[model samples]
Target: MKNRSTELREALEEMIAVGTLSPGQHLDETELAARFEVSRTPIREALIQLASMGVVVIRPRRGAIVAELGPQQLVEMFEVMSELEATCGRLAARRMTVEEQQALQAAHQACKEALDSQGPDDYYYRNEAFHEAIYAGSHNQFLIEQARSLYRRLRPYRRLQLRVRNRLSNSYAEHDGVVQAIISGDGDKAAELLREHVMIQGQRFSDLMASLPQLGKQAA
Candidate 1:
């Protein structure tokens, strides 16, 4: 079972991610404690954890507030994320075991099923698993750790991006190409495909920027 602080941290993280708590909004320990039926200690702990994750900022006198990333900062992070994923794809194509390859294929199929029947929210979970499989297939511990860390930090933005028009379908199509390249043992091809698949550019970048305000208004 999870500890009270851990549970609160995850709850708060989800609230922030779904925009029930908007960026730059204050987080009051007393209010959170009352809302979650917990004490101030746990709420403080939760806020501290979020601060460490860059999801919250703890000021000396102003308590805690949700952290905001500028467009340029967001884009830079995505660029790094794309390169990490591309490297993982390249290495996995050369290094994945038969079992790992099968796992990746299974994950891809699960994403397809979710896309067909369950909509973007459900597909997002499967999509995460599909990427995890590739990260593991690379068999590079340091790379995997770095990828997972950045992936977690960028989770909310990634989830939001899928809500863009036709993005879900386009994402799955890109996954198909990536999977094919990796399974065919073509490292260079897989790297290129994965980089393109993960990069946010041109129209996608515009769409994401346009959607940011909507996310802020979601809880209003």
Candidate 2:
């Protein structure tokens, strides 16, 4: 049962990633169960798990739906991500082994090469690897898990942002800054820089989302 639930979760996550199921769209359990050729029981369990992880929302008598990023949710998520990144940076600086530091440098350079190629797809993949390397280098299991969870939740939106105006270049510079801070073993500086870098991007996104009625207004 657990295995089926995990499989269902992965399949649904891939569906979301590929845009097969657009954000905030309704998900039918019967359709999903037939698609997966599994019992509805596993599908229900998977949907509940995804809801708990913020990947989807389940409304009473309304079935399951993909989570849409409104102005409020986006801003709140970025704030959470900012804190997580700050914690990752601090831990990476203090706990990173010599090997891990070197790997971080190499990862940054690889990402830079991808950005230099001027391909969004290549740059996006490399950028993901770079951040994952930092998360792994943090050496805090709980922090790493929390960061990964939020990261997956934000994946669709973040993927969209990679194509925003000059966002890729801007993100490259931020990644470089984080690498330098971590390599220098300056935990406080790393934490501070990470917070500013992430939070500022969140505010910028919030401003954009605010102008659209499709995205709900963020509360003060």
Candidate 3:
């Protein structure tokens, strides 16, 4: 049987991704258990795991809900994500095995091809794969795990922000810079470039919030 905790986690993640369990929205354990056809124990376990990953907040009487990233928190996320991505780039440039380097290159090229296809959605996941390849290439499992955690926490916002005007092409261009720096074995440069690259997602989200003030309301 699939692990109950994993099953619950995946179900909760899907709820968050699909807007059923929106940011700042309260999560009713009973409702979730009913919705997922699972027991409350696994639901609670999954929520606890999501909390550790910063995707949800669990309050004593108030219960758990998707995390609400305030302006300051959003900025902090951008800053932290940038630093983490840059570090991954630096480490990858220094320690990536030959096959890993090739894999990263292939991921980057695939993203490029997706971008050339000219649809926003076409390139989004491909670009994600490119960065993930870099994260793995860093040769630090702990860092990779942390980065993945943060990435998942930010996925809902990232998916929405990506749909903004011509953002896809712009994102592709940023990836180009990151790719060049990494491929050249310039660790510091790759680190700096990747840090800068990840910041664009923050900017896009910020801009979206500025316009859709309601969307910026507490995660719900």
Best by lDDT: 1
Give the lDDT of residue 193 in candidate 1: 91
Q: Candidate 2: global Cα-lDDT?
A: 0.80
Model 3, 51-140: lDDT tens digits are: 888888999998998887776676678778888999999999888888888888788788778877875556767877888999998989
Question: What Cα-based lDDT does every candidate model obtain?
Answer: 0.91, 0.80, 0.78
Better-scoring candidate (lDDT), 1 or 3: 1
Candidates in descending lDDT order: 1, 2, 3
| Local accuracy of candidate 2 as per-residue lDDT tens digits, 46-84 | 999899998999999989998887667778888999899
Q: Report how far residue 11 has shifted in candidate 1, in Å.
A: 2.1
Every model's TM-score: 0.93, 0.82, 0.85
Runs off by more than 4 Å, candidate 2: 37-39, 200-203, 206-220
Q: Tell me, by TM-score, which candidate is best.
A: 1
Please rank every candidate by TM-score, starting with the best: 1, 3, 2
